[model samples]
Target: MSFITDIQQRFKKGTIVEKLIYVNLGVFILTFLFNTFGFLINYNGNFITDWFILPATFEGFITKPWTIVTYGFIHTQFLHILFNLIALYFVGNLFIQYFTQRQLLSFYFLGTLFGGLIFLLSYNYFPAFTDELDRSYLLGASAGISAIFVGIATYAPNYQFKLPLIGYVKLWHLAAIWVLLDFIQIPGNNSGGHLAHIGGALFGFLYVNQASNKKINFFDRILELFKVKRKPLRTVHKSKSRKTKPTSKSTKADYQKKVDVILEKISKSGYDTLSSEEKAFLFKQGKK
Candidate 1:
């Protein structure tokens, strides 16, 4: 009971990245439990996996639309969840340093959606994948992790990671290698999954570019199509006869300047080198 209480407490207090890891872990255990229960009942098919894993065909997707996002949390194999959660922990923490937690959620979920869409489309349209459609169901969190990884790399192309053997490598260079591997391996065993990875990577690249005011013309316009319209909050400003206060534009300018400085520092060094105060300031600003 104490152990379970501790876990509950940790989950409640954890950051979004940590929460996501916990959710994935929990789902993984539950998935196996469901499989075991089925096995005991003389059933061979795992209903949890069947209903939650993203299907390759449009008809399968139509029956289980929620799988688009749910599949990101489901993992059948131990190594699959292990690697995914590890990537999510590192990349997701890096992501939140430069982006809001809300935006992290956006990239994660939208990445999954786009990845699933690509999987379905490729299986249907491409001649090579047409035969594999019935048997090739997608599962795992690779696409979301790829999006977060590529998104940050796109945001700070010059950011360097110091590896023991290889010294320092630019973030974009690593991203390029990652994507190239996926591209080259697409024709191998996991065509649908690799295609989905590319889809997520594209979203991350295009999204960060568009958000950073770096327009790729047609691609930027296409990203704009993903924007969701929410009801605007109508605020009525009254005439003030009192002393002058800093204008909103001026405040925004100051905030943006600070952000630019922090981002520049991140580009130079890495996110880990930031002082606690700097991290706090960035986190505070990110929430806004």
Candidate 2:
């Protein structure tokens, strides 16, 4: 088979997470090849040093609006891309087993978006980064990947991973340790990057909860706008058609029953009397 065809087959046969890893690696390899021996010409007249996500520079931000998205695709160092691709291949693949491709995609892009937001916020607002000389450029996909990692951990807290020395460890434990390390290291290392990591994690957690509730799927809404809406039936209520009785108990009935009990408890005792689990259940039912 042709080389290109073989790669295409591998991509098609791979899992969603695997496909993403492959795509990222492929881009990295192509970038390196195109810049082979420093013989490659700069297409946009920008030096490698100038090519990065610089939120403070209006010109940089406007001219390369796509940089917010493309920054994650570019890694200057070989190991920078190497570790990211490896982490994504393993953590991301495990995440997909529980989440749909749509969810994973949302987590990734939205995480990246929030990461940029935090980067801008920190650069513009923080005292350390406010100085012109101190302002720094951002690169790498670590922020977004951190989000995906923590997200999967949160959703399935009990999910276990075995380490070489450590026995099976719960996902939440791993997530907590990761967060702690980031928080502790923030003051010493790249504070902006750590801040971005937190932003991405928040997006990931919110995205998962939002998906569970069915309140809104951003992609679904985007697709809906382009979809042609059909007209309602003109024969509606022509003869007042007999109401069809539900064959089984309606979900609404079950939901109402739970609500009624909660209300009774609240009325007899007080709002504070409700346990956390009960409160969460009622809140979720209210959304329905």
Q: Which candidate number maximizes lDDT?
A: 1
Worst 10 residues of 1 by lDDT: 229-238
lDDT of 2 by residue, 1-288 (tens): 699999999999987677777767776776666566356553543343355454455556777676665566667678888888888877787665445555566567667767777777767777776564245666777777877988877666666666789886777788788777777877765776677777777766665565466675563453354352222111111122344433556866876687678755653443456799887765554323
lDDT of predicted model 2: 0.65
lDDT of each: 0.80, 0.65
Error of 2 at 242 (Å): 34
The candidate maximizing TM-score is: 1
Candidate 1 has an lDDT of: 0.80
Candidate 1 on 1-288: residue-level lDDT in tens? 999999999999988899889999999999989889998999988877988999888888899889988888889999888988998998898776666566677678778877888888889998987677788899888888889889888877888888899999988899999899999999999887898888889878877776546445554343356674311111111232333434699887997788778878887778777899987666565434
Model 1: runs farther than 4 Å from truth?
213-258, 272-288
